[model samples]
Target: MTRMRIEGLLAAFPKLIGTGKQHTYVETENVRYVYQPMEALYLLLITNKQSNILEDLDTLRILSKLVPEYSYYFEESICKCAFDLILISLGHKENVTVAQVKQYCEMESHEEKLHRQMREDKIREAKDEMKRKANEIDKNKAIHVIYRL
Candidate 1:
């Protein structure tokens, strides 16, 4: 029975992870994307990119309380798509704890930092553009904003 179940999981793994257009276990809104562990992490990272004040290690402990299964499983399955099962199970859960919020914030911040440095690059870009416009008004020439050395 256990062997059959594991075999079933392997057979249905792709569809369960949303890899196929017509999955047996789930039919996503797009029905085109694959759902995997990294994808979950990526989503978590993307949604909380603006939170910079999160303390992830501590937050993980906090999240463990509200979602011990999720918290523990996430770390364990950080590299697999099996977390999708957890995602489905936890989908309707209400009222995530502050730690869960902080955990997501940390996830996003780490992801964003990997792509951008100096943190507030977007804000600096807008400021630099305004400065360039002011400079152009005075001299009628293009001004360059070199953010890096």
Candidate 2:
């Protein structure tokens, strides 16, 4: 089923090529294929048809720029490193632009933000636990005093 679905998406490429124009995408009823032609290969992304085309184009542009930096040449090694760059590119945004992807790839502020958030959460949890322990101590002290009286 998955293979057939992929093949169906790929089938549109020929028609787009036949149109005698440079084509970057094709939309089907269920999905959209955004493609980037490389020196020896083509990178294609299949997404829901309702997705933002501009963002998809921006992503394709970013990927095209990033791929060369990872492998220097198109091969399986590029695939291994692609995910790292992509996760960096996405940052905290639902829709990523090329500039954001570039900035993230360089600075990696997302990881810093994530670390800071985790630190804050841990501190908050520690404070809550300390308060609970203090309350328990107070309750035990009160009970002992009442027994003494």
List per-prediction Cα lDDT, in the order shown.
Answer: 0.43, 0.72
* Poorly placed runs, candidate 2 (over 4 Å): 1-19, 75-149
Q: 62-149 in candidate 2: lDDT tens per residue?
A: 7787776657656666555544343533433266655766676678577799999999999999999999999999999999999999
Alpha-carbon deviation at 101 in model 1, angstroms: 8.5
Candidate 1's displacement at residue 14, Å, is: 32
Best candidate (score: lDDT): 2
> TM-score for all predictions?
0.22, 0.47
Total clashing pairs for each candidate: 0, 0
> Model 2 Cα displacement at 145 (Å)?
77
Top candidate by TM-score = 2
Model 1: how far residue 30 lies from native, Å = 18
